[model samples]
Target chain A: MQIMVNGTTHEVDVEEDMPLLWVLRDELGITGPKYGCGIAQCGACTVHVDGVAVRSCQLAAGDVDGEVTTIEGLGTPDALHAVQEAWIEHQVAQCGYCQSGQIMAAASFLETNPEPTDDDIDRAMSANLCRCGTYPRIREAVRSAATKLMEA
Target chain B: MKAKTLAVAALIAATATTWAAGETATTTAETEAPSVSVADGLEAWSRIYEVASHPRCSNCHVGESGIPMWSGPSYGKTRPHGMNIAAGESRIGAEFVTCATCHTRSTQGNTVAHAAPRVDMDWQLAPAQADWFGRTSQEICSQLRDPERNGGRTAQDIAEHLDHDLILHWAWDPGGGREPAPYSLQEHIADVMAWGMAGMPCPNG
Candidate 1:
């Protein structure tokens, strides 16, 4: 199978039913998307598909056949994305298992909702559970990123 | 005139007592099930209670940032979760102190001066909305059924949501201080479905 991740194309062989998360972590060795829960509950495996954040754990390999982006793909250490910066500014992570998911969810949220209110953030990010209880940071990151992204 | 005033006072007292009784009834109803059969409902009650009372539910159920009285301040505020040292949004702070700096994915319990540090399985914090605590099952049920309110899901979508969505499944995987729900995810869904199928009943009783 041929899959594109973060703009690079890779060819691999695996079960069609294999979860995108497993394929990424095991076959491709793209371990950025961690596996907190095989189910999408933890949002720890959140990644971007064509710019939309999705739970890679719940998505089948056959399902996400397009461009997939993990946390590594989002930005670089030297040139960090605004969301990453905002996450730092807001101190969003606690346990850090769910930060990738929180970041992915925030990124996806900002794409459409460039400027979100508290309620909008709640409704959008509710699906992405942060067990570390970094929700306040998630919201703050979203707000800060929105401002930063809009400025950019 | 005095006799008439006394009569009106007695009527007023009776009305006030009725109002007080009504308030008490609501309080009981709020704590107990909306109906009678829920006595065997301990399992069901606990499942709902766990989900409702868990940090995921309690944190959001409590208060947002900048409230007069914060529910759990151990996380931080200006830092989005304020405390000892703050990480901006990046999890890594201004000095490049990432959330991973202290809060690694796993911990036994990292202690903070003002508040205790989380050290359980993936201990961190539920998002800001977690402050919304002490919700009744029926209220959560209603929230789950409403697409506009419940994360943009429809009635049928809710069934799929429960089936496929994982965080909902986390009630069964609550680690450390938190235990999994008394009932399996399927059973909770079934009860939720029963209510959903019954037109998402809210307790008038």
Candidate 2:
């Protein structure tokens, strides 16, 4: 089982049906990504499969032949990636727990729609639940990050 | 700062009162008494257990990261649920974009913002870990006291949240399709208020 997460390749053993989320959280001890809802209905378990934000909870372990990036790999806490930095500047976290999944979703959404409209954000982020009512803030942070990314 | 504090406090107090009242409404004696008569945490913990386990709460108390989550079915042939809606990350339905698309907020006594059927406060599930799916009341009591696991909410915050949050109260008066928590919102509050006053004990076994 050769898989690269954040540029590190690792061989692991696990059942095929086990979702990638468990592979990250249990097999690899990557706890940054949370399990809000497992059925892929909630974006809390979102991670990158080849740079696209797909609910890792929905993807089985066998689905892991592609490149993966968890929140930990998104960037360092001290020196964040553009999206993370943008999240900080825009104050995206409330519980701060859902930010990882939200960030993953936003980053992936922006990749395809660099200049996303409000509807784009609403559609892209509609899959994630903040529980804290942080939707408005998330929308703003995403736009801010997109601008920052475009500038670079 | 005051407005924010008040808002949070009001949200906390209002929800808590509504939840508590819903749980223990039969106690006219309690209601006739002053509002200062608070409930204990253990008692509240039990009711919270019932509510958290309810579909309203349990549906969202998602398990061990990456595990599959649950969602209600759409309208039509769906027996358990009538709506064809799906709760994406927004918890507000992916394709449908209307606060009223689901349920009106104020008309019903529930937690607003696409609120629940009706209640004294808003409605939703507890934190994932606090979920009571086949779990015991003692287990829930213990979970509420923990910070790291409870989304960093402090014991005081938990007490306040349970006590005042209108959503917490909504569990009792959940419009339909489900049974209300075991106790009335008032009784639930008495238990929670007592729990906080009792040093928020976790029923040390």
Candidate 3:
């Protein structure tokens, strides 16, 4: 099947039930989305499907009809996304294993809710779990990212 | 309330007598004839109980809160559905992030272990009336037979639902390390159809 990932359409051969996570990491060699709890329980494998954050581990490569975006596609290294900038500003990464998923989820959440209250952030980011418990920093980073996006 | 309870008791007694007579007649009927007695229906219900109590079915058939549960042998711990997910009153998570935001139709055949299992339908929690978590088999049987609780489905409708609903089929296709519900889908469907045809009796009722 042909899937557009990070703005590049690649024809890949894999089973219809193969998760997009493996397709990204093993097949395409895109490793931003980590494997935390292979099940959807953990948000470590979050990615964007048509601008909405979804667990890549749960999503099938064949089921992806939308444009795919991973952390690598979120922004160039030279010009970081607002969320990335705020993540750096807040020093959100502790172990950094879940930061990519967190950042992806936050970016999607902010797209729909550019100015979110604490509750909104909680509801949106609740799916993503960080074992390091960087939740306070995550909230602060989201706030900062929202402000930057609004300004930009 | 006392009078209502007494009336219900009397009706059950009357039905029991009639059902006993029906069973006797069914015993002498043609071999092809279906056994349509309350006892047979309740017997079929025992099988349904096995399927319903399984994590694949019970996890999504939650209570009034509309929060799906995650428990049983596969999860290793019984708890609320992960990701702090909530379906709200919509039962489809529309009040928040919809289930389809992650669970899509038609997953790949070779999905990794512990990966989110996918099916070919829009995934959502069962309605409040169909809530089965922490319920006894008798209670679940009563609820399934109750028109109000079972979506006003008639016995035939219930059979059709069991035979066809793709989401319900997920019980047998639960990928990853999750165990499928007891019995094959075909056997479960047969039992469900028989129970419906036999008057959908509850063991306690």
What are the root-mean-square deviations of the candidates from the true structure over C-alphas? Answer: 17.0, 19.8, 10.0
Off by over 4 Å in 1: B1-205
lDDT of 2 by residue, B150-196 (tens): 77775445554555555555555655444555655544444544455
Residue range with the least summed lDDT across 10 consecutive positions in model 3 chain A: A116-125
Q: Choose 1 or 3, whichever is better by lDDT.
A: 3
| Rank order (by lDDT, best first) | 3, 2, 1
Best by TM-score: 3
Residue-level error in angstroms, candidate 1, position B11: 75
Q: Each candidate's lDDT (Cα)?
A: 0.53, 0.57, 0.76
Best by DockQ: 3
Off by over 4 Å in 2: B1-205
lDDT of 3 by residue, B51-153 (tens): 8888889999998788888798977889987777877778877555567666765634324565555676778888888889889998899888888889998
Candidate 1 docking class: incorrect
**Tens digit of lDDT per residue, candidate 1, span B39-153?**
2233333344555565433542333332212233333331223222222232233221223222322222212232212222222223333233556765555555555666675
**Per-model B-chain TM-score:** 0.42, 0.52, 0.79
DockQ scores of all models, one per candidate: 0.03, 0.02, 0.37
